[model samples]
Every structure is written in structure tokens, then in C-alpha cells.
Target: MATMPSIRRASSRTTRGSAVALALTATALSVTVFLGGRTRGPAVSLSIKSPATSTISNGARCQSRGFRARAPGVSVNLWSGFGPSLGRRGLSMTVAPKAQVVELVSRVVPAVVPEDDVAIKAFSSTPSEWKGDMIIIPVYATPKPEGAEEGPNAELTGPAKELDGVLGGIISEMIGDASFKGSKGEKVSTFVPGGSAKRVALVGAGEKDKENSDTVEALGASIAGVALDAKVASVLVVSTGSQPDSQALSSGVLGKLYADDRFRTGDNVSKPVKLKSMEIEGATSDALDAAVKHARGVTSGVRLAKDLVGAPPNYLTPSSMAGVAEKISKDLGLSLTILEQEECEKLGMGSYLGVAQGAIEPPKFIHLTYKPKGEVKSKIALIGKGLTFDSGGYNLKAGAGSMIELMKFDMGGSAAVLGAAQAIGKLKPDNVQVDFIVAACENMLSDRAMRPGDILTASNGKTIEVLNTDAEGRLTLADALIYAEKLNPDKIVDLATLTGACIISLGNEYAGMWSDNDDLAAELLESSKDGGEKLWRMPLVESYKEELKSKIADLKNVGGRAGGSITAALFLKEFVTKTPWAHIDMAGPVWDAKAGGSTGYGVRTLVEFVAKQQ
Candidate 1:
């Protein structure tokens, strides 16, 4: 929970028809009446007798006036005011119990803390100008030789040189002793005895030649990990070597500061130490401004994705998920269209409905659009698989294959696209129009659940044979991909946690990419690289389509055990024929086994790719 600034309370009770005169200021606005004339301890009535038509924007004065009322049972509504329509509105209200008034006001102000309360700032100032609880300096894994001079080593070239001089060569001595080689994920900390800063932390950046946005972001997150429970009010990150990508570095810090402690209970519960501010040093004024804009969009998308994926299945059902989408559209001013299950059936989404039939929850097909102010430069469609929970249907995941408890995360792709929509909607590019699509549903075990050997047709008239019910993600995506193609966008990209075979091929650190067009594949690769995401291009393998061919239907949902990921991609390719399309299989990197929580993969990639369309 975030600590609220001091609030001023004004209280007073007046008998019915008896008026109390009060002076109103800029911070405190007029009052609104609730449950009018309801009586309890003291029947306090309020009327706006003053002609204070001017509105106040300051929050402090509002708190001050809230507590200054004379009536004991009177309560001031913090977020109330009068406007032109109801001109000459005043602050006169009646209340019930005296004790209930104060308690209600207290509860209303700081009840639920939204996830984006923390602020991240990037500054053009030097290390010496930053004073905080802790300052982090990133150093290369290799250090200068014992007898090496100052100009020869790149690590000592920038603000780091001045920092070392201030600390009496402590950084150099620590690196010289071979104790802190600055290897990735390595850290060392010490107290700054003379400076304004209380502590200084050194983080590893690996080899200089191999440095990229990923390495820089990893180093930033590593620093945040140490500061998590240190009760540090503010953090400062200083660049020692070549300046890393400012946006990636700052985003990593912001993503870590976000905590999902909403449901935590018990006396020993750990509360995240709220950070007052985060500052990164050593950038020009213009550069700092650009970095701040990009980081704001990317971090917001990442946090939203993490929040959705972290939600339990029961709490985030298909209906509730549509509710969230509706709220986002309302808040961000995006055009939203939600199709009910009956409407989807009209479009002949047999493949999608087949997987959804087992669950009691109704399916929702979500379509959200973002348009620029000027003439559009390009059109792009982003589709995400929205299986809120996957029980492997009738195949029934058992033993080692069953990770049913963690099935809530199967909607990672949906979270990413929605997160990107939340970002692009706010960061509105001037040239591109984007459509975000998701077919949200669940695959649960029941009498109506989809079974093996089921034949289903997609919206595009292509049939799929469901050989293995566990391969249901692709079934849901088939109709979504077909729907996206009908929009006739220049390019389409779909993200999904489709197959474990990709994890086997590329480990948990990388996502597999399959594309039919070379240019589209290369562009997405470069965008992911700049966004600090790892995407490895895999072959479309023309021959792999042979494995998906079925005896009766157009294709099979699963292609045996060999090259399973490629075959799944091939199945989706059947639906998208014209528009250049790329498929991202992110089964592995979406969730991390590390102690704290999810890594929030693919959000940055989607945001970056869409932003570039500008």
C-alpha cells in the first residue's frame, strides 16, 4: 500500500433547517448530499449558502475543508463539485452517525492502491547531483589492468571516472582485486561515508562488446531486486560504461517496483517498500525526454500484462475479462466491440467454439481499435490467444503433464496484446491504425468438453481434426487468425503459448518466430531486439505441412511429437493466406521459476512493433 499525504478533516453538525456558514478555499470544493435527511445521533443538515461559483483544483485545500465542518456527523465528499449546468452549487449536506462519517472518509481515500502508483524519472544530471538512499553503478565484467592508465579503459571514460575520484579509487580497487568482475547478475554494495548518498551498489554488465538492451535491462532489474526490501525511499542509477538504452534500463526498474499483493493476508505479510522516485543519470536533456516517453508506454503495457496473468482463473473469467476490456476502452478512449457467444456462432467459428463448449462460462470475442488523428500510414492487426484456463479438455492432463494449477497463465498472449492496446491507445501514434483481437474462453473438463477426434471448421472454411485435445490453444487461435485476415491489414502477427516443443528447442530465455515473408520476419526481429526481447527465427519448413494433413479434414490440430512447434505454426498458416503474417510461440518465457513472479514477456515486443508503424 502507498502512504497518503496528510489529509485535513473538518467536521460539524447542525440541526435541521439551521445553517452553518463556512469559508471555502481553492483546495476544497462544494459538497454533495448522500442519503438525504437520514437521521441518527444528530440530524445534521447541509446547504450551500455561499455563492462560491469558482472551482478549486488543488487537493490539499479539499482535505482541509473536509475536516473543518462544524457538525459532528457531517462528512465532506472529497471528489464533489458544481459546474455551469448546476451553477451556484454550495457545500451543505446532512449525515447520520458521527463515528461512521470519519471512518468512511478515511476508508474512501486510500482503500485500494492502483499498480501504477510508483513514478520513474530519467534525468540529465550527473552522479554527484543525485542524492538518494542508494545509487547503482553498472560496471563491465572485465576491468582495467593493474597498471593500465585512465584513457585506455572504456569503463573509466565517463562519469564513472569522477565517481572513482570521489571514492578514493574504491571502484577500481574492488575491480582490481578480481572480487567483482561485473559479470551479469553479480552485485556488490558499500556505504558512502562522505557523500550525501548513504549507500552505493555496483552491478555487473557482462562484456562490453556483447552489451545490448537485454543485458542493460537485466542489470537494472538486478539492482531493483536488491533494493526491494532495503526500505530505500529513492533509487539512482548511474551509467559507468557506454550509455545503455535509457528506455530499457528505466523500464526494467519500473516493472520490478510493481507488486501484486492484493490478496495477501496474515499478520506476517510483507509490504513492498514504496519507492518515492527512481532516477537514471548521464543523458542529454533531449535524450532524457525521449527515453521517458518510450519507457512510460512500455512499462505501462508490461505491468498491465503482469497484473492480468497473475489473476486467478475464478477471479478473471471470460465475462470478467470482457469487463476489464470495457473499462480500459472507456478510460483510454479506444473503440471497442465485444461479440457474445451467439454472435460468434453466426460467423461459423466452429474451431473456437469447440474448445469453449466444455466450459460453463460464455465466450467473448474482443475487438479493440486505435486510430491516429491524421491519415493512416499503415494498418496492422495483432491477435492473441485468450484461453483463460486450459484443462487440456477431454484429454485430461494427468501426472507430470498436468500443470492445471498454473493454467490461468495460458492467457499470457491475450494479456500482452491488451497491454499493448492500453499503451498504444495512450501513446497514439500519428500515422497507424491498429486492431487488437482476442477470442477469450476456457477449456475445462466436463461432459460438454471438447473430445479427441473432433472435426471443427474455422471461420475461413478450413476444417481441423482435433487429434489431441491438449493442443487446444491452436484451435482457439485458428478462428482468430482467420478473422484478422478478413480485415485485410498490411501485416498480421499472433502471439500464443502454443507448444512446449518451442521451449525444448529454444529454452526458456527465447521465443520461436515463424513467418512467411522475409521482410516482415526481419522487421519484427529488429523491433523485438530494440525492445529487449529475444525472438529467434525458425523455419516455416514447407515440408512440415505434410505432417498436419488429415485423412478427412483439412488439417490436424497436433502433428505427432516431431517438430511439434513448427507443425502448429503450419496449422495456423492455413487460415492466413494473403497478408504477410508472423507467429510467435512463447510457451516458455512467459512465466519465470524465480522466487518473485512472472517476467511479463512479449509486451515490449508488441508495443515496439506497433509504435514503429507510425
Candidate 2:
């Protein structure tokens, strides 16, 4: 484990307003005073009132207005001037105030600070300071060039140091660290004392920079993570500028926050945390409200997925997975059907049943449908390989392969599909119907367990040669994909932790994607980028199909070592006739030994894609 640097506490002060203002001008200043459990100090209130212009002047009096501070000598200063179209710019006293915070902060701090320093600062801040908080940030924005609003690269800068410090502190605390490791140009947190706020966050906005929506989203997420955990009911984001739209900033931040790790579980086993409201300062009230709503919805979807993925295998087994769908249908007014082992047998799912035969628990084939509230325009089907566990079957794994103990994540595909359904159910888009199909079972070892070289028939009556029992994910998906095609879907997307070859091909950073349709691939790629899930498309070579051809069986369960991932996808492609389809191999992302936990990878990307299509 890495040790984070401690947040150095500055000394306390009770100077008249003027002395505190003068103190702020100095390079290193600290003001620490214990206010009545609720009230912050007078000088600190003045500083936050109008951080840009309100110099820490002498004898500043603190007056309270609902949790906000008002005082003499407090005035607002616009940095570069406000505008709708300012390109990227760094934060400097000389630059226009319109710059984005990310650019400005990036220039001042080392490149590494975005991830490391932010994490450190966030973790170092005390949780008490973060409790029930509202941190205000003042920023400047620049005007855009005439008639160039739609031109490429019209993005702007964000808030300044005050904002970064607050965000960093919140993030560090959430991840149980004082510092953060994040993407580039992101500001970390800094500390401020004395205000109604338990903690005041100050972020810097670079001069003359345009805004990047993604950066704002990240900001919102960081804030929410801290606020919710701190048991804070609300957060007030104060922006300084005539044209500063609080709604836009809030929307961006909240949206991103809601999306990231929305589908996660805390080890503490505590009750769920909820955020009540977010108030925006210095920006339009409409934008603030819109931001709040968007954040709520996005986070709601993410949390649903996280809850499903985080559940242990015992609680989320095949029958339990079916039960989950049944409950969702009853609660959300959706349609659901659960097929038992007898039904699957009637459908001739021999290849799928072969894997289930090993386990004492019966397998379940779940079909969950979401009907449109209005006219249906597009119908899509999602198939997930719900292998509860993989024990390597007859060709039992040994030594390093024994690490397959975490194979419970083999059902990660099912988690993603179920998670997507939950999100769509809440959003309730019109004219788009979606069906979720999961072939849920366990691949265990027993007297009746499947053996290598065994031949099994699929639901489509196609015989499969099971050369390796370890390759059971594809076997289950084969029947599920065929079942999805029966619905005549406009598009079919299947997710599975099917192959280790995928881990080798794309590493842990990216999921391996195989698709025959270019349009589907493009749409999925765009969704992945928006959702912050990395995916790399791999070719489905025509030659790879040869590896699955068997002398007796219609296809072989395991392909050759070379292009093993691609061949596995090729095997699945044979099940779908004309429906545009894509396969996501999530072997690398399902579980993380290095991180000592599960990643919950495909849920976000799948949900985003489905929501966008609707």
C-alpha cells in the first residue's frame, strides 16, 4: 500500500477583517479557529463572498444569510470577462477570466499533479470538515471569436485553485487516501478554513479558456462522491462571472459523478447514501436545477448496476438472477419470463446444459423484456453469459490456473445485461423495446461434469464439439444468442467473460470487441468513450472460422491458441443469422486480482449505449 502525505494544518487566527485580507496576500497563510459548531469566522466569510475581488481587507464584519456569508469590503471581480465562446487558455493573472479551470491548473501544476496531487489532497482532508458541506468556487470565462461558435476546438477552461482544492479533498477522502490519481489537466483539492461550510473548496480557472463538458462532469462526480459519503444533504457550487452558467457547470459535474462507479458496493455493508440537493452560486438557477436532475438520474442508473455487480455469487446465482429479473419486472412494470432446466432441455440446449450438468444447482434461462410506453421503433436484444463459476471442467486447472477461484465473475456478462435493464426501466424511453436474455448456470466439477471431446447439441439443433470444458462461456452464449435471434431483433449485443485471450489481446485497460456490423461498432465505440470504458475492436477474420469446424459436431467449443479470442467470437457469430451483432469479451475486466476487487466494467458502457439508442 502507498502512503499519502499528511494535510498540514495552518495556524488559527482571529484578526479583524483587514488583517485577514492582508494575510491572504502573503504566500503562506493559515487561519484556524473553531467556530460555533455551525458558524465560520468573519474573515473567511469575506474571502468566500467574492474570492476574486474581495481582498482580505481590515475589519471585515461577518453577517449571515441562510448559511451564506455577507460582509463589508466583499466585492466580486470578473477575471477575463464572460462569454459563450472562449477557446482553451491557461490560468494566469494576465489571461482573460474566461479560461477553463482545467487548462489553467494544468499549466501551474506538474502533469502528474492531476492524478497524484488531487488524490493526495482529497484523502488528506478530514471527514469532519467534509460533513454537511457546500464549497464555493469562483471562475472567469473569455468571449469566443465572432462566428466561430460551431468551429472545432471551441471548448473553455474551468474553475481555479479554490475549486481544485475542494474537489481533491473530497475525492481523496472517498477513495480513503489523501491524494488522487486521475486523468490529465484535472485539478486536485486545496483546503480553506472558517465559513458556515465545514470545508470550503477553492478551484482555479485558467484565463480565456472555453469549457469542456467532460471535465465538468468529472468535477460533479468528485463532489457527489464526497458529499454523499460525508452525509451532506446538499452542496452549493458558487461561480463568479456575469455569464457564468451555474446550471451548465453543475450539470457537467453531476452527470459525470453519477455515471462513474454508480454500480459499486461499499465493503462496510452500510445503508445506501443519498444526496438531497445541490445549489449553484453565480450561475443561472435554471442551469443549476437541470444539472441537479441530470446528475440524479445518471447516478441512479449507475448505483443500480453497481448493486447488481457487487452482490456475491451465492446471492446472485442462476435462480437468484432470474428472481432479480422477476422482481424488476414486478416493480418497474416490465415483462419477464424465466425458463427452468426442463424448458431449456425442451429447447435442445445441450451445449449450454452440458456446463450446468456439473453443478448440483439447476440452471435458468431468463428473458426479461422492456416494452415501450408508446409506439415501438426499434427492438434490440441483449444476451449475457451467466456462468456462475468456472471450475475448468474435466481438464481441471492447476498451479497458477488455480487462481480461477474468482471465476464467480464469469457471470459479469449477466450483471451488465441486468444492470442495463434497470437503467432503461428508470429512464423509460419511448419507441424503443429492449429484451435481456441471460443463460445462467454454474460450471462445476462432479461425476456428471462435462468432459473434453464430448459432443453436445445446441438449442438450434447444431451439434458442438466440446474440446475443452474451460471454454464454457461460449457454449452457454451459443444457445442464448440463437434465442435472441428468434426475437428478430434490430440489433443484438452479447457480453461475456469468455476468454483469457482477450486479456492478452487488450490487457486490463481495454475490453476486446468483435463485431460484424460497422454501424453497431461505431455506436458502441462512441458510447464507450462517453462512459469512460475502454474498448478495442478486433477483426473477425474469415479464416478463424476454420478452427471451430469439427469432423462430427457442427462447431468446436475451443479454438486454436492463435486468435483464440477472435475464434471464440466467430463461433458465436454462427448462431446469429442476419441480426447485426457485437460481442464483448470482458475476461480482463470482470475481476481484478491486482486491485483486489471487481471492476464492474461493461455495465456502464452497455447502459449508455442502450440509453442513447432509445
Candidate 3:
């Protein structure tokens, strides 16, 4: 384990409107302090002494060691990234008249794993055999013999036996007392007295046969959360009782360590977590290496999607998003075509344009293509709804029915597809062609916004009656689906945060999936299982189509409240009659309120499905 360099910090307490004296030495200089807590004055005074020498050593203590202000219980932390220098002849103090003291922090490089690389390794070894800062061992519930006593049973097998022997039968003792039944989510941890390892954790997987990729992934995530609190830099995970999915396990381990603190500032005291590496025991094979590589690729895409979704609307407009796509295409050597508003008008995308008419920002119709170096096996199209900000248009969102502030994440579908493009472009699997499409725009309120009864024509010349302007994502997707179908792909899949009904049905844990083809649906389901994303199949009930009937146009933009999600899927199905089609309603699982980050839900599933098809 590599040790991080330590920085010394110190704090002081003073009475209201008083000066705190700071003594200077040959190498040390006075540091700037901000009084936020435990101070009662609107002004603060500081006294500094000039340093005798101009140059200082690398580890010179210019600032006080991390300490609390004794006077008013305030904390003091100085910027440690700055080199030792006063650069002045006289000591001076810049005072500000404010209610609280302000602390100036120097810019320092954060200690975290690079977004593109995750350190993970797999081995076929026991936990006790591998040395690390800590070892995470998973144990599943196994039934004991009917006549067996309250002691070691025949079911004690695999790594469990080896770990029990290594711990001097502590694991068996716990099992004998019925203290560790191996129920899912149950955990027990202990410190090693004298061994290569410092600590050991036993996590439970409910049943041996019931374990899958999701179970392993969840277990690995739990381990990461606990280990981060423990501040363990390196970890070794030992899987017992059954084979765990190596990719899912590793992805979970790294995923939980992901923290987006790009905007963090001020005199915060919590230390940042920096996990160096993770090694998995009992996961040894050539396929396992490939799985780990694939896992890294998918994780990169998911991270990109989450970043895009979390970005503020002002920073991620349609034009700005196109600029990002342009850079990604250039970097990955993929073909990129960006259509401006006029170009889309020439293409007669009325339904898409109608939604854009309300916003001041110009719409961007982005198309990206990826081709393999070898012979092509199949062509696939992925379309995403890119309403960067959805304000529900003319039938404006308000009160409880409104979440206008968080509408910046309306482009979640596009973020997922773009993320997949980033991964696939780098992975470059042979014998497959993919087309990525997004009708990126905003749905804001304006005089030009489409009215509730307005009729708009799609690129396919299908007229839609706008029953609810809030249902604008489907309109944009309508034209994108038509454009994708023209590419003559073997299959087409479109994803959107289109309806609340889907969220009501599936909640935030799983995304709702609907498909016209059973084989395609089955293939995607299997791929999602491998990717560790939960997806539930939904029905495209034939009766739901009748609810979308428009007296004036070919169809209504939205159906009534009852079975609204099914009707929404039915409406999208009209645009792609020639191709095998599937619709993924990603309204739920995109934003994680509990986890406090964009879930990046569909990127891994898409990448896995496409990779297998290739």
C-alpha cells in the first residue's frame, strides 16, 4: 500500500473582534484562516510574522497542524498543495467585514482513481492465502444435515472450510451458535490478531443456488461502502460456496468508490476516500480477464452518462451536447453528423421541430455511426430522447405535478446511448455496425410552444394530436425513430424518460422494457442479466392503442391516465413498422435520490447486448 503525504494543519480561537497572533519561523509562513463556526463577531483580525529564509523544504510546516480553535470550537485547515514561500518583504493581513471568516484553499490534485481505469485483478486462491489490508469473504446459507449436532457440518465446503481453519474455527463457532445464518445483507467483521491481513469480513448471500450476477454485484457494493468507512486502501475479495460473476463483482467494487466532487469547495473536514486496488479470489480464467475488461468499458460509459445527467441545464444545452459528441466522435474515430435546426426542417421533422419551437436554443439532430474492421454481421440502431430541459411545454408543469427544476436530466436516454457509443467505439468488436441517434432539444414554455390541441406531422408524415404537451419526449423520438428506420437496421431500440406511469409500475429499482419481437426481447433480457441491470418486460396490450385515437389526427401524443405507459409504447411502435423494435421506458432508475447520483441505468445493458450480438 502506498502512503499518502501528510499535511499539518492547526486552528486558533479568539474573542469577538480580536487579533490572533501567528508566530513565523525560518521556514514557516502564516496561513489564511476562515472562522465559520464558534465565533460571534462580524470581523476577524490576523497578525503574521515574516519568514527569515526565502526558500523552504518540501515538508516544511508553514501552517499549523490540523486542530480546532480552542476559543470558539472552530476548525482550521490550510491549503497544503502550495509550495513553501512568502514572496513578500513584510507580513500583512487582508481583512474582510463579514459575519463569518472566509478560508482560502489552494488548488490541489485530488487523490482518486482515474475515471477511465479501475484497478482490479482476479485469482484462484483462498482469503487467508492472499495478503492484503483487508479481505472480504462472502458466505451463502447451506442447510445442515438432519441428524447433525451443533458443530461442524458436511456442508462446510470450499473457501469456507479454508477460512474456518485459518481463523481457528471462529467461522464454525459462529455457525454453530446460529449467529451467522448467511441471510442476504447480513455481515460480520473482525480484526485479525497477527496475520498478513488486518481485518476480515463475512458477507451473506441468502441461498447458494439463488446467487447470480446481481447478488455478487450487490455484495461487492456493500463491501465497498463498509471498506470506505474503514479507510482500507487495498482489498482482497474471496467468494465461497458458488461461482460469482467476476465482471459484476469488480464493477460493483469500483462503482461504489465513484464520487463526483467536481464542485466541492470551502473548509470541509471530511477526508476523501481513495481506494487503490481490488483483487478477487476464485475468479480465474481467460474469459474472466475478458469479462473484467468489458466491465471496465461498461463502467466508463456509465460514468459518462451519470456526469451528463448530473450536469446543470445551462452547461449541457443541445448545442453544447453536440459539441461534446463531436469531440467524442473525433477522439474515438467514429463518424459524426450534426444536423442544425434548418437541416431538420428540410427533412420535414415537424413533430420534432414543434417541441423545439418553444425553446430559444436551436435543436441538434445528432447521428453517429460505428463500423467494425471486419465483415459486418448485423446493423443496429439506438435512439434516445434528448429533451435537455423539459418544462412540460404549453400545458406547463406546476406544483406537485411539476419538477421543472430537475428537468435538466430529461436527456438521460441520450446520455445512456452516447455513453454506449463511447464504450463501443473504444472496444471495437468485430462484425457489427451501430447507428446512434438523438433528437436533442429543450421543451420550454414560450408563445411559439405547441398548444394542447395542436396537430403536428412527423418525418414519416404521421400526424399526432398534442393532447398533453408534457408528453414531448415521444414526439422527438417519433422523428428519430423514422430516421433510424430509414437506415435499414436489423433491429431498433429506443429509450426515453417518457412517463410517470412506468415509474409507478416498476418503481426506481428496475426499468420497464417492451418489445414487438420475443427473440430480441429475450436476447436483451439475458444481456441485461449479464450486465447487472434490472429490467422488467412490459406488455404492449393491443387494447391500449384505442386510447391513443385522435379524432383529427392519426394518433394522439398521449393517452388517458389509465395504462398510460402501455399506450405510450403503443404510440412509439407506429414509427418503426419494418424493423424489429423495442422500447425501454427509463423514467425510473435514472436519478438515484438515495445514492445521490445519476444511476447511469441502461448504458451497460446496451453495451452488453451489442457486444454479444457482434
lDDT of model 1 at position 72: 20
TM-score of every candidate: 0.75, 0.65, 0.75
lDDT (10s digit) by residue, model 2, range 494-611 = 9998888899888877888999999999989988876667888999999878888999888888779999999999999989899999999988777655644555577667766876
lDDT score for candidate 3 against the true structure: 0.73
Off by more than 4 A, model 1: 1-118, 122-131, 141-160, 163-178, 239-242, 267-269, 595-597
Worst 10 residues of 2 by lDDT: 113-122
lDDT to native, each model: 0.73, 0.61, 0.73
What does candidate 2 score on TM? 0.65
What stretches of model 3 exceed 4 Å from their correct place?
Answer: 1-118, 124-129, 143-160, 163-178, 267-271, 542-546
lDDT of 3 at 611: 81
Candidate number achieving the greatest lDDT relative to the actual structure: 3
In model 3, the clashing pairs are: 9-64, 9-65, 9-66, 10-64, 10-65
Model 2 residue 182 lDDT?
Answer: 29
